[model samples]
Target: MEYVVSHIPQGTACNRRSAYKMIPTTITIHNTGNPSSTARNERDWLTNPSNARQASFHIVVDERQAIECIPLIENAWHAGDGSGVNSGNRTSIGIEICESGNYAKTLDNAAELVAKMLKERGWGTDRLRRHFDWSGKICPRLMYDGGNWTGWKTFVASVDAKLKPKEDVRMPEEVAVQVDGKKVGVGEIKDGVTKVPVRLVAEAFGANVLWDAKTRTVNITKKEAV
Candidate 1:
C-alpha cells in the first residue's frame, strides 16, 4: 500500500531534491526508551529542547499511527555516529517506536510503516537493518534481546510482495508484425518485469507513446502506425 503520513506536519524538509536521491539504505529502530503517549508528543521533547540533543529520524510509530518526524532529505541526529553509512545520525533512517520499555505493540505498526516507506521510495529490502547493527546501543530491544526479529525480518520480506513489475512480452520473438502497412519488429527480451520502458518496445513496434505523469502511471497505447 502507498505510504500515507498520518501525523506528520505538512511541508517537512530533509535533504536536497535529486533525481536519484538515495532512500534509507538502513533502518535503525528504537523504542522511545521513555513512556510517551504518542510519537508527536515525543517529537516535542526532542525538538523543543534542541539543546537536549539534536537528533532526527524519518518516522515515529506509536500504538495507533505513524508520525513523520524528519524529512527524508535531512540528516537526523539518530545514529549517534557520523563516520559510518549505517550511523543513525547521518545516513540511517531512524524510526522511534514509542514504547514504555515494558509493554508496547508498536513493532507490528513499525514493520508495516517500514515496508510502505521503502516501497514508496523505490528502495529494496536488502537495505533493511536494525540500530544495533550501526551502533552498540541496544535499541529496538524487543527484536534484539527478546528474539523477536521475526517481525522486523518479516516486514523487510514484504518489501517486494506488493510491487508488481510489468510483464514483458517480447514482440513475437523471431516474427514481425504489421502496423499500418509497416513491418514492426517482434519479440525482444528485457530485464525485470512490470514497468518496462515502453519507449524501446514502442520504437521496435513502430509506435509512439505519450506519458500522463500526473498520476505517476505511464500511459502506453499504440504509437503512430506508420
Candidate 2:
C-alpha cells in the first residue's frame, strides 16, 4: 500500500522520537486500541507535543492511507521492551493498525504494507512479530481475539499469502545461434543457461569440435576464446 512519509521532527522530545539508529530486522504489528482514531489522527498525536508519551511507531495505517511517523532507519518507542540491542524497539519496524473505521480495510492495508516491506527486503512471513511477542501486552488484540490464537494465525496466514513469492515458469526458450553475424543453429535457453549444438556453431566459424563419448566431453579449439 502506498504510504506518505510525515516523519516527526528530529528534535522532538525523547519520548516522541529517539536518536537511536536502527536497521530493522523484523516487523512488529500493534493496534492503537483507541478504536476511534484514524491513521491521520494517530500520526498527528504522535507528533503533537501535548501527546507526550513514550510510545511511538513507524507507520499508522487506517482504511484510507498509511502515514509514516518515523523513518525505518530510526528506532521508535512502540515495543514496550527496553531499548537493548536485540529489543524490538531497536530491531523492528513498528506498524500500528488503526482500528477506528473500516477495520477489515485497515487490516488488508496493513497486510499489504507488511508484504511490500518483506518483498523489498527479501524477508519472509517469519520476520513478522506481534507486540505481544516483545512484551506481554496484548496489542493487536483484535487479531488475537482472545486465547485460542486462531485470529492471530489467520492474520499471519493472510500476510503470508501476500508475501509469498510467485513461481517462475522456467520454460526453455529457443535462441538462434550465430557465427560472424550469420545464423548458424538454434539453442535452448533454460535456467538462464543456453545449450546449443556446439559442433554446428564451431564448424560455421571454421573450427573443429569433437565429442568423445568415453569422456563425455566436447572439445573445441580456437573458435577464438572469450
- The candidate that wins on lDDT is 2
Q: Estimate each model's TM-score.
A: 0.53, 0.71
* Runs off by more than 4 Å, candidate 1: 1-23, 83-88, 100-105, 146-151, 154-226
User: Residue-wise lDDT of candidate 2 within 21-59, one digit each (tens)?
Assistant: 999999999989998999889988876768757789999
- Lowest summed-lDDT stretch of 10 residues in model 1? 11-20
User: Worst ten-residue run, lDDT, model 2?
Assistant: 143-152
How good is model 2 by TM-score? Answer: 0.71
Best by TM-score: 2
What lDDT does candidate 2 reach at residue 92? Answer: 97
How many pairs of residues collide in model 2? 0
122-218, model 1: which lDDT tens digit per residue?
A: 7767766667666666766655646656645554555446344647666432444445666554444434323334565676565556777787765
Clashing pairs in 2: none
